[model samples]
Target: MMPAEQAGAAALLRHLAGAEPIETHVSAVFVGPDTAFKLKKAVALGFLDFSTLAARERFLRRELEINQPAAPALYRDVVPVTRAPDGRLALGGEREVVDWVLRMAPVPPEDFLDAVAARGGLDGSVLDAIADAAFALHAALPPVPGLDAPAELGRVLAGNRQAALAAGLPPARVAALAAAAEATLARLAPLLAARAAAGRVRRCHGDLHLGNLCLLEGRVTPFDALEFDEALATIDTGYDLAFLLMDLDHRVGRAAANRVLNRYVARSGDAGLTAALPVWLSMRALIRAHVLSRAKGPGSGLPYLARAEAMLAPPPPRLVAVGGLQGTGKSRLARGLAPGIGAAPGALVLRSDEIRKRQAGCAPEQRLPAAAYTPEASMAVFRELTDLAAEALHGGHAVIADAAFLRPEERAAIEAARGGAPFTGFWLEAPPEVLRARVAARRGDASDADVAVLAAAAARDPGPITWQRVDAATDPLPAVRNALGLNPDDPC
Candidate 1:
């Protein structure tokens, strides 16, 4: 239902757009033939007050300012709805101002990522692009000044608890989840402080879910960043990313979530983010739960509440390494296994190809020169892989090291990187001709391996293969899952 105070502005927008508006609690977006106009509701929610003309105009302009950089094509100038001398509400005129509207380019309903996911269209390419888009946004955002990570997180948790209770969710469950989250914050305080000091705290898109992303200029672009509160928008990058991750896990699947996560970490090289992921993921889920409870009653949010609790108590961390010669489906198997391994969205995949690309300061799909693959360079990649794996493992998240662990030392180092966590090694095997064909068919992959590279690797004798070998000529995922004691149909 439209608010009484916004009727005139809403009527003006309706007449201009010749369409009904898509409404949220705080704003309504009216899409016309060529452009869209966003109007703030004149309601004073405790967290934000858009009750007055000045306040609504201020936030409309702020929305324009915050969203233009990320989605320049979507956000346009802010215009006023004016009351002319003739007592007509017009879009823009040099007259008495009544309300403000942010003009933007219209996005098709189908272009939004949430709509895409609804049709099961979030394939690997889209997921990778989404991660890249998120990484780009985070990289562009400047670090926040004087952010107290622990205190900010604690305040958010407290607010979530209060909102949950007020929304009539089971008090016992809400209290328990809040207690768990507070303890997690207490445990991670030092690390969060260090991360803030290291500039990991940035003014990010506070609400980074699928609904806010759209296809723009043939690229997956993020839009509608939180503009009402600077404190909410300023947060640790991992927490900022958690909203998207949590949304993916709920709406799409864990595999999609895991892929985006690994891709984001691969691009940003922020593996330490995994340390705080559980609480971050839980907090995101809790936010959704309470919001849903308030909107649709408590029962609508039980699933999200359950998800929040589950995220806090994920299975213990473990290490899984998938190693084989070129084109043996090592990465494929690793990806297949990761979502079922540990935690809500599963294990962190550290691929040597992506790592090498990171070291060379290039995109994963870009081909690197042969000079970049020297033995020293290769060793450095392995070292970084182990280091990242160790960090994620210590943080109680599973790690999947996806590389051609052809050398004895490389295999041993990965095993030791587990750091007291259980380790499983799977060495994929396939015929030489099959590997050659597969390598030849590859396109746009992170791996730069070719038939010649495979031949060279085949020439070197990688000593004693004791790891479980899976025939890669057919589907190897079933065997890998069986060995890992995971049901083939498990959804993590």
Candidate 2:
């Protein structure tokens, strides 16, 4: 197309979308009041070859097809930008197509998760919405057939390293990043293969960072699936989710990021991902770092490099135990505390309630028989918690043990898991009436402890508690900070 024709097409797109055209490194996005038009740039990179018009159209179709399920209502169709005998540009014209554009319903610009973070709108409820949407899609998407996730992830890491080197990053920094990635890959190879064979690899929304997510109809919806590469899109579900988790940690505060991960795990029952996150999350950050380097150069990618390092090799692990009577908000404090404790996505929360349910072969909300909570069963639960905590600590992840450790002996077992790491033990307390009311009002909790259980717990001798006692009526975050010697204002 000639310069005048290109200019005409630009004007047409702006007119059609009722807004100015916004250009990305790979595409032009024109956002209108109600609709958006995406125009692919006539440029080719090694990973993507879209310099030709035909190539652009093919990718346009791919984008439309793949992204439709991600945000069905948002991705309307692909509209062609064509020229007429009058040498004027028109949208969806019958003449030979000059260019192609992906048309989508426009989500609120300010409601993009990134923008929400900027405006301080990423609250717990917002994060819950985001987690719900992401997990729903994960469960909804079909599994990839015969995928070898370890090999695929290895290739992605190599590509990221190459891109970093090509972007003129300092050789030492690139090499260090590559080395960390290689080490993590080696540790995760067998686990990655197992997850893939178990059908945890799926066709997912590949570009799931906050920018591509927006609040539509009051729910967080992910858009812009990876149309450039199917291999990149079909990935381990946990790894696929790592991008959003890393993005949240990088752009928003660590607390929001942690909240999202914990909530998603609880809702999705994908606790298996907790251990692999150190590797997957680091890979996600490094991939972002290289992608940013390709667009804005190495200088602009340093922050992401630092984030990658933190994810790859976080500060040494620590053990935090949140225990108290049934209604003392121990679980609540544990979940909130997990995000800011160690590295990205925070900690491995080994909840006694969750473990017990697993032992009994029941769902979190299912009622267990009297035998399920027998002394033997309780001992087994505590033992599993200790083992899980030790495993997480050994794997270089922080641990949060959430349980009603009314007995000092039970608490001691958890404390034993703190090998080289610092340990913080907290016992939440409240009035008997408060505990009764809280347990009575509980809904959708993994714990089956009710008013009767709380009454029984209150009557039992706690046996010389060594953990710090904190008020359950007030915010536990202050107590957590105090225990960790962090400043009151520290968002971590």
Candidate 3:
């Protein structure tokens, strides 16, 4: 082992042998059999360094100060490592101080989200709790200005490109990768500026994978925030969340990722932050690839590079609408179809009901008065719907607009907005009696329309709608599959 490794091992042994300890992949943790102490390795990386004793002490203090708010139960204090008169290492001894380490309270490994995920048991409740905790952390963290946000991300992408090149990647492949990174940065510059102005940039847990979160005594806790540099940790809040989002995506849990993101947005009420998610997720995946490229371990950079490429792959822009009367399951089918439609995870779902409510300046669950449902208001809603769909599709997203296209003009507007891209319209239909019964049984819904409204909508002429009709009584998945031209058995 090199000197740093030897010192790390010695520090681990000193801490572990002094108490009943838990061994992890990187750190040998001592649990006081109750208190936990983490010692930094005397190593230097481009972004962080613990090269000197003083540097280590400084960062150790910072770790405690920064993490205490988020993980108050875990970050106990920062303590000095001193040498005894007999030249033995001891924590906070009376002799001259040799080093310092972060002291925390050891929590059970089963409390960690990774452990839960490993056990094949991550539920909405756990995900919601995690999202809430992360939102609180982001809200509490102080902002750091003048960070090299884009340049740092570009460096990561450039490093990945160089690694792919060093491994004999094709020139065209490398060029394409560079171009994608540059284009993404250019596109996101305005959004980044807006986010910074909104105070969304903050010093956060630079590394917020599932492994960094735990359930301590039935409460969620986050630990081990980046303490070396404010610039590394101080980033857009979307970037902070993207770490976990990308991790979930890598695990093939895109649905879970969506659930987490939606829950975070709902809790934080920061829907505008989503405009930056694609850039942040791309950056996070690139950083992961860069780190893996430097690893000498079993699973190296090859798989991560492939994942990065997949993450950075540009999706074909298309607008598909799931249109039907109320209670015809448009939203349900749209939700089911979105992940598999070749768009990034959490692709935009623009529901006409939500858009209509927004146009009326009310909440989704609030009822629109009679005047708010006038023909003029309806036209305005349709116009806004088409506008949003066009914008999202133009921005390289596959969109599913859930609405009741009862009017010929409304349907025509959507078709016209497709703008030369292949547009598939899914029309869900149910028997009149069945539709009436379904609408009557619905509860806690936003739509003011009842069976009478459904009857009116059904009688209206849906003229020249280029759509595939799906039977609402049967499994909508088959029709959805056929509409998207995918195998029904393939798991999205």
Q: Which candidate has the highest TM-score of all?
A: 1
* TM-score ranking, high to low: 1, 2, 3
Deviating ranges (above 4 Å) for candidate 1: none
Native-referenced Cα lDDT, model 3: 0.71
As for model 2, its CA RMSD to the true structure in angstroms is: 4.1
Which prediction has more favorable TM-score, 1 or 2? Answer: 1
- Candidate 3, residue 8: the lDDT equals 40
Model 3, 445-467: lDDT tens digits are 55788888888888877776568
lDDT of 2 by residue, 1-492 (tens): 323435666778878788877777678788988888888877776788878888889999998887787678888988788788887778886997888888888876787888989888898778878887888889888878798787888898888888778876677977887888888788878878888888899988888888988887777888888888888899988887888888888888788888778666655656667667877887787777777777887788788877777777766779999888998988888876776677667876788887888678665567787778899999998888888788677667788899988887888888998888899898888878888888999987888888888888889999987888898876777767677775555455
What TM-score would every model get versus the actual structure?
0.98, 0.84, 0.74
Q: Please report how far candidate 2 places residue 127 from its true position, in Å.
A: 1.0
